[model samples]
Target: MTVRRPIQRFYTEPAPMNKLGKPHLQVVRSISVGQAPNIPDTDGVNEMLAKAGPSATLKDVARGILDRLVERPELEVQVEEILFLKDCLGASLEWLCSLAASDGAACFKRPLLWSGWCSRCDCEAKDYLMIYTKQVNANSCPGTPGSRSRTPSVAFSRPPSWESLDANILEDFDKWDFDSFQLSEATKGSPLHFAGWKALGGFLGEEPSDVFLEMERTSRFLEAVEDMYARQDTVLYHNNVHAADVTQCVHALLLQFGFAAYFDQLSILALLLGAIVHDMGHDGRTNSYHANVCDDIALTYNDISVLENMHISKTFKLMHSDPSTNILEGFKLEHRNRLRKEMVEVVLGTDMSSHFGNVADFKTLIEKLGSDPAEWHHEPKAMSALRVMVLHAMDISNPAKVLPLSDKWSDLLRQEFFLQGDEEKRLGLPISPLCDRETVRFASSQVGFFTIIVQPTFTLMAELQHRVKDVLLTHLQTNTEAWEARKRKEQLGLEISQALPLLKIRPLESTELTDLAVFPDTGACLFSPSRGGSTRDVPCDSQSHGQPRVPAVQRNVEDVEGSDDETALAALAALACCASVEAQVAKGFHKNRPAAPAEAFALFY
Candidate 1:
């Protein structure tokens, strides 16, 4: 397996960048937003003070649209389109991330000014960004992977349709079986706002009854998160839908099992908000990828829980700098601090490096609590522990979902994994586990994931909340069996392909063979009766979508009637009866495929 090899290889030392080491800039509440412009300082104002700089002017324009967004009871257009239009800052992926990280006070405030300075690092032009990353890795040069992409800054170029969301699909969002993907499609690529709205506004019910924060603030914050996860070339599994998924799961874990009843409004809101922003600005690479590559962000965070630390820091900074994104703006200072602290703690707890240990620690706590989730209410530490486990579990809980959702999520995750593997292959770094596409088996890999990570997480959930126990474990079992079945079929195809050359006898000259496909090189027939003209049901269809599914010739060649070597003839007939190595080739899997299930062995031997 190319699994451990690539993950183990190390590249050159991280180039030291003094600029990267600079302190993370904090926002100082700047010029009052939405105030009337000065009456023309030409009359009696000092020359230096009356310059009316770009920052002041840019803020004036960006803020011009802010009032409309904030005050309008609803938006007819997508928030991103309105926010990222030319009249506003016209932000790029990197600039948006930088704003969340350090440049917020300047970038968004004076986007044009910073544009000339950092336009090269646009995250939207990911091909260029990747090229620059490779050049840096190849040279071990004194530059950060992202900041020097030298690509043109792009407009947020809104993705998906800008039409209004389908209210019908969103009506079922509260259910455990709710599909975040469907929500994303319904919300025009901005489902987080609706999900976030429900988290704070609807879910809170009359908690702290008097205060009502506008959806605008919460939507802005959540939209920023969705924006950060959008990448040009990379497919992001931790995008807004995953964020919404975690938020929903956190709610179900808390409210369904009586944990929310114990926690106050603020604490519940803290956990929900944490789920919303936990993966903000995710670039789809794991922490180990960052640390190994010596990415600028990793260096800034000291290579320890680098992505987690960056997510919370940049995200909170986004909230701090923009009133539109700061949902906690009017709360009591102490309440804000408490919520922020808990949010940060829970987000940090999502890093996988500490996953098993955290799970073990939480398991120990569960043992102490003796299957009672209500006991967590009295134990503050236990409550905190529960919060950590819930988010971490839901964050990785796709496997515990129904077949299609799990399949869709797995496909997305593999896209991300292979993207990283592609980079690792280029940089000569060891490919991390499950990242290498050429060597990894899609179906079998998930079976191990189910065993190691997925099972334990839901087991803990079952221990904490019995209501969800059957659904969670049942989905897990179904998904596991489906993958196992797929794995077995794939193995049969592979083994048959391997044994083809041994059939040294002349190829069967048959009149009945209608549409049997043969390898040009091997002369082995690949005949899949099930795949005959139509696409199969998908939960990771082993057959590549590229394959022609139209019905081919159909005939079963069984034990060549009077064959002298009966066993050989029988093996050949069975081998010729089904799919083989071409299936793997069609799916773009090369080099090595996994071989585990023994059921395939019984067929030919």
Candidate 2:
């Protein structure tokens, strides 16, 4: 039977009830549209919003809906009702309706759900909706493009096989524009920016002119690094896109937390500029790669994380190569040294081997800051400590950002390292434990590395730098949990379970339309169901008007027939796992990629 799904669209509808029991009708639009007209352009919502004042519930709903969906459209499907409510009630209500709308707005709009309510409560339905909305928002936040739970890149093919995802990573490497980045984007001219801008102005000790120029210089450096980092072989699994993401995160932290006032323009510029270049010469091999076979780049830096340090120095040198591009040229000699030292400290801090000593020193400094908030001075040591802590945390911040993202990164790095180990085997070289191609359960060691090395380091730094406290703490908690959780899974033999396929997917790559996942356990290959199907088993039924519900059953390929049970189930499970992983990776990739016209969402019928 052909079932017509409601086409997501915008329309003028009856005003929803406001808190004041006032009549309000609003123009409701499905968020799938590419560009949203001004709320004022919507039928009657803006008129009341203006009359109600900015603090009015109607205003908040109108403003919040527009702001939330500006970057993400998938959210509309999840919160269509809330958007609809805002469209209708925002025009006439002043109190209860507004309050309910605000609660929904906050509950549904967070990046992730942090709490859950009792399942049996009368309001449980609303609570569950909120929880579900939180998950949807978290899974669908702006920074993470395709991640449902921040898993690494995975791929699925009609017949799955291993393929390198380097190209896919490169394509998405271009999307991040340094200058356009914001810490807290409330509205176009919101009070958030005004305060941040003022803080930055004060921090720089110069008015807008000099500070803006310095930012421009910083942006140029970031752009160049993006270009260089995107080249083949520079990044293996953790590539330029990862660099861009971390940079953006750091940039956002600086703006969001109002750190701009504490440090000077040189300091801010150094942190940002250094971030772009820090990983430029990374070869996917750990620092141990320094001791192996006199790597060409290693030879140049005398094996002291020479590649990273050189990346910093080379980036600056390149900047100075062209007079027009020379950001340091305009600075006074003392200022140049200050900028150089700050940049050096930040870039050098990326070395994971020295993370303990570095973060410890930073923690000591934070301890020294003590209870006096005003005693802070602009000393090189002070700036260096703060800058290093931020860059260091950023370098290792991936796992802490989200458990799935961290685990995925660890998986990819392990894969790439082992791939290198495979090359070693082919070349008659000794295989390293984590790096050896012959190694099975390679992820085991990475879990340890994350626990012992990566986790503690970032946790300490987060304690020191409040700017990324939320981001860092989240990562740390998630990292520990992921490790513990993965261990539990390993104990259950779930790690080796063939419930999911092992697909090698890349970020930001166009997937072939014909490829689909097939689960071996259930013999259920992916069938693109165009219409809603329901069963009594699901408590909250999303039922269509006239369709009869199908009874729940356990069968092999009953829905999509003509496929063998074992083969199809294996294929389906493998494909599903791969697809899940791929979707997560795609989000990160696209987020890092240069902005282009949005890719048309692929639909299955």
Candidate 3:
């Protein structure tokens, strides 16, 4: 049986609803002459979305299908549902991309679902779709001819392998754009184990009594925390994956900024642990939910930083529960107390109410450091303050990520917000800002958030940390401008793709097309690779405004069957942190490369 992959949505009839109530969403156009437009130039997609239904539900179905396929690809059953959902997902994405692609007067509502759909779907360890997330703002996908055939400057191939991902990702430990979702999938929904180990490894290994024993001890603590996040009560956004993302990001920031140069090992451990367990007992709803409803946790802490206090207290209680899990057991009373105090400050800084105050305090501290660098160069006395501020930044650092990742986080956050919004509506409470599914303009809100919160805070980081200025702050600027452009184009009803120029993926200059991650619209791969290897040191494509020359990556013959069972699971475990965006550049540039191997999802009947 020949199964044609439905890359575009064809309309004639509304699709049939499956058991879950979400419509199959599209009819596959028979392979006729130009059956459907690459981007629909009408309001049909929006209409389809209204009737075809929630992309989030579709995302869940798609993921379930993929998970089953991943579990038993060898089964002879040909699931046409996979192809159907992929088409629906593609069509759903088209609606979003169409919002940017054409000049249309109708604005989309329920804006929260877009990012949730994309982030959750994209994070699939085995995604059925190949849409790269580059088009909204990064206008670097090659519209020019002969761009893919350029020669390589260096050799690079694929992101760190997903086969041994956790162990593999540590090699790229300092990269800021870690994909905790990928790692979560690899770790079987428990990313904290790998991320925590990576973040806390330095401290745990420093003059350890027994290195293996210390490793085991840290694992116990991390395991307990991961279990907490992965409790029966599921948290869509503030789960283990988010914890891992924050933890790895904190670890990366510390390394990139060289905080270890000033802060002691204990300070570093405390900070890392703070990131790991900061939201240990999060019940999905925000502190406001706990407070408004007068929940036990809210009452226990008198409704002041209720969630933050619970996180810290619960973490400590869990640590003290078993000797194996108590990482600071060997430390003296004073040292342990100091660590606990510092951790409390760090986790408390994450309270959303304290966000602006923390930023203001950090700004003041930055000024102080600037005014008298000599005094602080030797003292470093405000270590706890600095630690708290840094955790706060990392906790809200989703906007600091590159396009693909930043959007993924936005998707997760908004889903949580919308869920909260639904509860508020049911209970007759005011919906939180950016949480409402009906009235919120997500793109505009993101622009405002970037302008008001993300830019200034990261600007402070740029001033304080030189590497952030060179690497991180650059991404912040690019991401901010992208969101701003999205808002502008959306308001004007102009084609977003046309407003931006076609540029190149600069980070691919040192890698190969083996890193190609295909996008449905725009060049989605973070970038095209340069040569064959040596991509580890390469920064993301956003680091440079200058487009690099694209190169062709040719492979004669190599194994691509993809690992399964224990080996694959172990690798997937570590993928929580790193999945190179550069791999999505296949169709954008280097189109002449050999057909992708089966392992990379090059399907055949």
Candidate 4:
């Protein structure tokens, strides 16, 4: 061998190798004793961390070292070390650490580290000399030497938190709706004095001072409204909050896309105020309740839209209870009646079982508007029609939400309805279809209900308005599929181990069904999958009905006694007719009436 000259290793002028072969493997040395140990390789990053201390995690150490080096120009580390620092301090590292830890600590404390660096020069520099290298210049000198000149205007700019910014859109107005705001002592003197008054502020429309004062005076009216909503048993499903949402939606419709000009300030005020006060006197009973027990409200307005008419009247009664609570404070008598009528029409339009002739009529007006844009503004027909449709749509719009938000509302309504269903059971009343306490999965029922009532109504509206169809369709399909999948899972009766990955389903809630429709307060649901989609009243089969079955409530009302009184009366009449005809045939006196006049008189008597 040609005496390979002991392959000498090069060193920078300042660094000194150990004259005694090499330093001991375990010996501690000051950082200043050598050229920072050749700026540490990627492996050296981990080794450096281990050497630094036992308490620091790989992430903590790596990020700490790089951040220190980056901030201080005097400090330097190899590109490999920088890359190791980035790997150790990345979101993946935090996520992994989070998954391993019993409590998520790393994710909560996300630390920043360098992400970009060069590798070829870093490896070459580390091998050539036992010294670390900072970023190289074009000519390979360390730090700022032999590199492109830094421009006078060059500056580092902070990057935005893109993920955080994107998440804000969903949360912007979630908690700002009518369902959230309630009156407290702090809000007593504001323009939101009544139950959900802040949500009603838009209804004031160009009359801010009047609205504020009206709110102040009518603060006490909340007691009655709350009492109506918070009844002990039976589902008084429609409450003041729901009422407020309708009013708010109408206000938005009027303000955002002002309807026919005829519905001036007076029309807007009437529509909004009526929407709030419409469902006031609901007794948690159905048509029977309207026709029987709470008949005063029905009789007051005749049999037409009985329950809705009652609620409208009760709302007025609350206002008349106290002079201060009266909303017609400054209005003329004629103006007050006109406002009252407008309010009545809007309120009565929300009855699910009530006639939708008004809705049909309103649609006609809208169609007419489509034909003549010039005649659309300020037309009495269009104003009335638009007002009714808007209120109706809002009452049924909860199901038209994106799943996350829609599911939330659904859950809340479900809880409320279940509580009501429990009360109905206690009171010996029939449980409504959607309100059945034993409903295992509400999601499927929701899908069916959506198919029947909610979707069709919205589809019709979307067809006419030509706005929000995409959002509406997306919501419809999502909810439908979600509910259908849930039902299928329940029907299959499979546990988690048996559950197919594709069949994962969400549990049902009371709110989900109500979100689809006003949960029928009574137990007589018109739709059931078990009955092959028929509205027929039949016995519920727990086994065939899937896991959670709707429990039947015993009706307190009278039942029809089949063929008792009417059947007996009809039989007696038939017997008499048969006997008379037989007597005529047996005597053979068909044409001898002249001779037997006295006998015929006796038979007649």
> lDDT of each model, Cα atoms only?
0.55, 0.44, 0.55, 0.43
lDDT-best of 2 and 3 = 3
RMSD of each: 22.1, 25.0, 33.6, 26.8
| Stretches > 4 Å off in candidate 3 | 1-163, 166-168, 205-213, 231-233, 371-381, 489-605
Off by over 4 Å in 4: 1-196, 199-215, 218-228, 231-237, 256-262, 281-285, 288-304, 355-359, 371-374, 377-382, 412-431, 439-441, 470-473, 493-605
Q: What would the per-residue lDDT of candidate 4 be over residues 178-282, giving only the tens digit for each residue?
A: 232222122222211232332333222111122222433334454455556533234324554455445555544443333323355566566656666666655
Model 2 scores a C-alpha lDDT of 0.44
Alpha-carbon deviation at 554 in model 2, angstroms: 21
Candidate 2 global TM-score: 0.47
Question: For residues 1-605, what per-residue lDDT tens digits would candidate 2 score against the true structure?
Answer: 99997534334445554444545434343434122212222323434454655345433544444444444556534333332322232122222123322221121111110111111121222212222323223333232111122221111121011122123322221222222112212222121122222222212211112223332333343445555553324445545655655665565556444444455546676776676667765666665555575777678778887767767877777877855445565566786787788788788888776777876776676677752222457445766666777777666666665555566666667777877787667766667666765435543565676677776665554554554456666656667766765454343233224333333222112332233334442232343222232222322223422222222223322334443333323333333333344554333333343332111111121
Per-residue lDDT of model 1, residues 222-245, tens digit only: 677667765324557867777877
Q: Which 10 consecutive residues of model 4 have the lowest summed lDDT?
A: 596-605
Task: Supply the TM-score for candidate 3.
Answer: 0.53
Model 1 worst lDDT run, 10 consecutive residues: 35-44
lDDT of 4 at 129: 18
Give per-candidate clash totals. Answer: 8, 35, 37, 12
**lDDT (C-alpha) at residue 283 in model 4:** 54
Give TM-scores for every candidate, taking all chains together and pairing residue i with residue i.
0.59, 0.47, 0.53, 0.45
Candidate with the greatest TM-score versus the true structure: 1
Weakest ten-residue segment in model 3 by summed lDDT: 145-154
